[model samples]
Target: MDHLACFTPGDLQSARAPDLSSYHWRLLAQGDSWFSNATAKLNAHANLLQELVLKEKACVVNCAGTGEALAHMVDLESAPDFVRLLSSPEAPVWDGVLLSVGGNDLIAAAQTPAHTADGKEVPLHLRLLRRQTEWGPPSAGVARYFSEPGWATYADYLRSNVRHLLTLRDQGPSAAKPVFMHCYAVPMPRPAGSEDGGLGSSGPWLYPALKAYALPGADWAAISRLMVFHLAQLLKAMAADKAQFPGLHVFDSTAVPLALATPGSSGNSGDWHNEIHLNHSGSFKIARAWSEHIQNVLAPPAPVGKQR
Candidate 1:
């Protein structure tokens, strides 16, 4: 397990509100339609809460995921509209807010493919397509990845959406509570004849220190680095906006970040499916990491003592 998983929800027991288990956790997972994933994690997290219920405890309730949650926000609408969608004081007041939005935004930025309502073929970003592994630098092909019809609009949308979410995080009574924000999907191996973009697809770009991504022949190590790159952008953005949102505290999900996805590595962080979402083991690991993140926030920083 990654060191991040070592954390446990210690003092959050006290932070529990009345019937918190019944409290709603409005999860907003954008990009590539990852609702099932959001719901699944919500279920897994809910199980933990269910156990707490017997102890007369409670946790956040969960909303549906994918575009359903964020549809209103990203609906080719105005920025204020997005803000209104997010910060509105609605029923089942949200306690914990989890987001996985930017992956789609980046995908849009990358100008990837689009299928018609009837599943007809549409143009996909040629930059992403690979006839060989030795493909290099930005080019007409690369333009598809870095540029698109809605690229500029999508980038603007992302910036605004992020700002709105942060503002909302500081709005409600549960403002100071936990906000579990997931980063964008890392590029990984995309199975041939499949476009789920879950795991195992290599990334769009790979720079040495700044970032890295899986390649055609990449081992696990390379894949893991890409995952971190995707995730890091979100974390870094949140940290940058800290001053704007004092009530919020961002979790470095990429903390103790995966070195690489080599088989039998100390941390099995990345290496599974390459894209954004994790596999069974990976999801649990992330859930555990989130639990720990919540624990860290509710409690004082622990002393890093030598464990006997």
Candidate 2:
């Protein structure tokens, strides 16, 4: 297989051929709010995947949602029933399984209310304490004000979710077919405070990328590394459990050395949009990572001809 180096999300979808529209592959996509942008892109990619795989009848099923939503994918409403669902495979459980999860779990777990010194509430301060992030990069969230210990808890949740997904992958798939996923993207950070006294305006839209506060007491640098650690751990676990999941396909989209290593905050910048949702370019950036990973998993070198 030759190497594929550069691409944006648009290039991925736009590059498809008319003949590429017929492949059908069963797919399920899910992620927290951070992945909302990528979800659409992944669906488009799935269409492409389906088209390519169509010589052998298949279709993609997009299961995009928040972590809160993912818990329910297996009917979490009934914990016991959900457990049963995990224990058994139902219809359309064949072919391929594409996932984008864990981000929502991080977001969901990170959400907590802030309190005053006397246990009273401060609206502005509470917002900070809650870490009420709106996606983009962690550029504008309340990371700075957060203490080292609290951030560590958030890190635990991130790692736990990845482990959980791997267990599911090993159990559900027939052990032969590939289960693919990417390392969720990290939000670009802004200078500690960039809004009305550091937090800027709580605008519905993120025009000027937010620059949040960097509190002295918090563990700023280490926080970002934690996400990568979880991703690495996930990959390592999968790699080590060779027999458990023989063909687990994963791509390290966690850090972009090729593009947007330094995400900009003005005029659409480079890759990020708002902090979480990626622009077409950003999505493609990830898609490019995905494409190469898929190429290796499905084929060392994908032929121009249809993939059955």
Candidate 3:
């Protein structure tokens, strides 16, 4: 809501792409709650960076939907222009594209209790842990979210979507564009109810599933960390393959420093507003980090004629 003037209604409805002819630099962002963030106003972190930090005319199209629906909303074939600026004869080359996805995908799958090979229900975090018996060598973690038929299937889905985005960047009307993706911030799983209009109004987000697996409330902190860390590991692994994804980068929002955890501090926490979403202060911390990262990306290349 912060920059209602920045995006037209069509952009919000995903009906028509925004016109980018007037701006010197443009960015197309596609993803979920992290970027849209209805919970917090001033959802346009891009605008904040452009105004206070970069001091440039940066046009942003926020096509972030819910986690369950985001991938499809920005499908390469469906929304080809969702992650690229509108092409005009006089338009400057796009500065970059930002993708804030994958967290919701993982979150949805994680909340489901997957059945193990032995017909036992297991939480996602425990399934990923290496286990061994006294009589045999250690076995690897459940191939992936145990419910999934095969881990390769999910990996393929992620690979295909991301590959398509990178391909889009390469084929832009302008020169090759940088593609940046962000990892979700670490969220703690506390049992605070929605009494104060916290995210708990949505039912503790991932708590029911954790409870289904009989995980103790005391262990929620460690489990929460494990789940988030696992997702980060997967993303970092993909980003490390620079050969396969040139100019692709990840903004590690998970690394943002935070104050100590306080009891009964649901919305008061300096880092999180609830289990899943960040409060205003928390959002700014991340937006600032993103601003710095983007500034580096948008830096102009040294001039060839100035070599002397």
Candidate 4:
């Protein structure tokens, strides 16, 4: 991966080392833990950006950080560095932008406790999942655990923020250049917290949220899968609607066949470093598939007269 050079916002802005023109592709990356977690120094625990091996030499100026939500990422006040590097006069002409957001936002929303108009508290109706007592019979599948109105509100919020992000990109030097995003793979509900060699630990997000709603342990995986599926559909819809999100490309990372983590694990299991983040093997698989997809998209169209 020597062909790939990654820099923090400060390093890229101040030094601008490794002349930008040297790379075949110059990209800007912004997102959450997937893009910027430094819990472990080993390559095995490197974030998505560090694991990427593109078809051509590429340099990425990363403005992402751990625990950043989509709303914060899109906010000018919260993301001044990202804003400046993207749209300012001194901004670079990036070949593309890579984004890894919405995951944290979803988690936060799921964990939100329901509140009454009178400011009273309610435990049965969480922001995303309804309590088991409110669920339909087991035959209802994953649909039984979900709150329709809650999901609708969340969907609207996600779409609106994504549109805001697109607007920001259009205002930048990289206007109309491809902006690539991914639908995250489904993770099993577990007690796995990302103990990244003790740098800092966080998560088991969905696990606790579901527990608070008294969801059955056996149904955790199915519930999580359905949630991820819906998210993927939303992203696909945005990509298809060129009128709204032109040049937006979404990689259906969920389609990648990676091993699943065992339920109830407190540490690394299968390909997962924890509950939400992927370990080296899993990340590599996803990165390779995504890289190939991007390469195909960037390839020039065949000449009209040429046919096999």
Candidate 5:
């Protein structure tokens, strides 16, 4: 049995959906390359968390994830397709949904200033304003062109999309299902040149972006760390607002000690395949965290001893 499956948007539309009712835990999500690569190796004995859960007869199904694809399926704009897939006879009510969004969205926005006409990054304040307003001035007839929106806009969208998904599920068969998401682990902004034959020379993935927007006179590494820290905080804030939304949980993988140990600091690139994705050892660590979180959520409550 396949523990993980990857799908493209087209693949999802045309392919027959699988019956997930028999599985102990059903998961729905769209992640970047990290989720794809990690889960693909999950069924093997090498994956510590996967093996542990397998003992409890746990099974998981990965719906769709691909490199560079925005994990925007939770957005309201994706509702039609999401409904079509979920309503199919083969689909089942999910136990949890793992959301792997926002990271790539942030990365894209980080690079936007470099790609602009004048090569001047939009002021952080103005960019934040645009996002806060939800991209502003709704025009029905005008075709949206190639203007770059800021990360804050995407952040707002991510939060809104999650709420929409929750509402949709709340009205359906999966009302009790919990939503799980993770904070991206920190990465050293370095190039993966021919020295490592893996995600080759994806030169300075975060460095250039951080350099472009970092505060003047600030250390680039510190800037990168701060950026990552803020992203983690954003996720935590979203998870903590339980009064506003329920059944939402976040796994703070970023807080794991080794995650912050960049090359020349506490460790080297041995834990990384590239500036972005993790190597086997690194992926295993993240997977273990995910596995533990899932197991804890699925565990039955201890019997309450009656007051004697």
Candidate 6:
């Protein structure tokens, strides 16, 4: 199972492939750390793009960066490379566009401190998790720990930015081409952080926030699962409304059965490399499932009688 050949925008632009015709599909990808390596400790060689295996050979030009928020990625002024490659006069007609976003945005919102560094209380709309005193009735399950107003704001932000991205695509050479995205697997709120000898470290994003809000350790996993479910549902809604996003396609990567991490482990456990990102094995599982879905969409099976 060979992976697709992926290159950065600079690499592709400086040295255009001598034979673009050789590849079955030419893809343009952009998003967050999932499409690029976020932490060195979590299998430096493994990211979504690197792990993706298509039935037909494809050359992927990736513009995604590590730790980039969805807001930043869609900002034309901040990230010009994506726009330049997709809409410029010299832009190629991409077969499809791959995206791995929304996760970072969710993480950013979830990790917001209840109080600011200056000792000011952050507004409810600015915080995803509610403090112990702010929790709703006990019957609400994981919903009790979250602020509805904040979740609503987060949902709206995701919808609008995705719309902006699609609108941008419509303005480019790849208009009406399939744009694929995927949902994330639920994560455990543990003490795990992606740091190996301090080369660079990140995460345990949910744990700190949960602890700050005085959430019980027993409910951490359910709370995390609920948040991911909400995010997944939002993406599904966007994909279903063809009027808003004509070529948008989202596959549920959460359907893949990766092992769950232990409740309090600080290092690699199950399929997770750290608190947020998947390890090599887990990424491979997701990439393979997502690749199958992409293949079914782009190249459906031939009719029973049409076989040669």
Off by over 4 Å in 1: 1-56, 65-95, 111-156, 169-171, 175-178, 184-187, 192-231, 255-276, 301-308
Question: Distance (Å) between predicted and true CA of 293, model 4?
Answer: 1.5
Task: List model 2 lDDT by residue over 116-230, tens digit each.
Answer: 4687753542231233342234674433444445445554554455455556655664335676766666654432111212222222121121223223223432444454445
Residue runs of model 3 more than 4 Å from their true location after superposition: 1-5, 8-22, 37-52, 65-93, 115-156, 192-201, 260-268, 300-308
Candidate 2 segments exceeding 4 Å error = 1-25, 34-59, 65-90, 107-176, 191-239, 243-247, 258-267, 300-308
The best candidate by lDDT is: 6
- Arrange candidates by lDDT, highest first: which order? 6, 4, 3, 5, 2, 1
Tens digit of per-residue lDDT, candidate 3, span 1-308: 12212453256457565556666566666666566524322341222222214546666665552222324324445443454343333333656767776766665555554566688855434333212221122252322223333334445566767776677666656546777777777677665434333332354566666665555556566666666666676667778888777777777777877553454455446556556666566766777777667767777545889755
The segments of candidate 6 whose C-alpha lies over 4 angstroms from its true place after superposition are 15-18, 37-42, 65-75, 197-201, 303-308
Q: Which one is best on TM-score?
A: 6
lDDT (10s digit) by residue, model 4, range 1-308: 33358876777647546688888888888887778645352343567777677667888888775433223335457667788887776698988888988777777767776556786765542377776567877788878888777778777887888788778878888888898998898998899875644434366688988887787788889989988888899889989999988999999999999899988988878888888888888888888888777666666557788856
RMSD of 6: 2.4
Tell me the TM-score of each prediction against the true structure: 0.50, 0.52, 0.69, 0.89, 0.68, 0.92
Rank by TM-score (best first): 6, 4, 3, 5, 2, 1
Q: After superposition, how far is residue 202 of candidate 3 from its true place, in Å?
A: 2.4
The TM-score obtained by model 2 is 0.52
RMSD of each: 10.1, 10.6, 6.4, 3.1, 9.1, 2.4
The clash tally of candidate 6 reads: 0
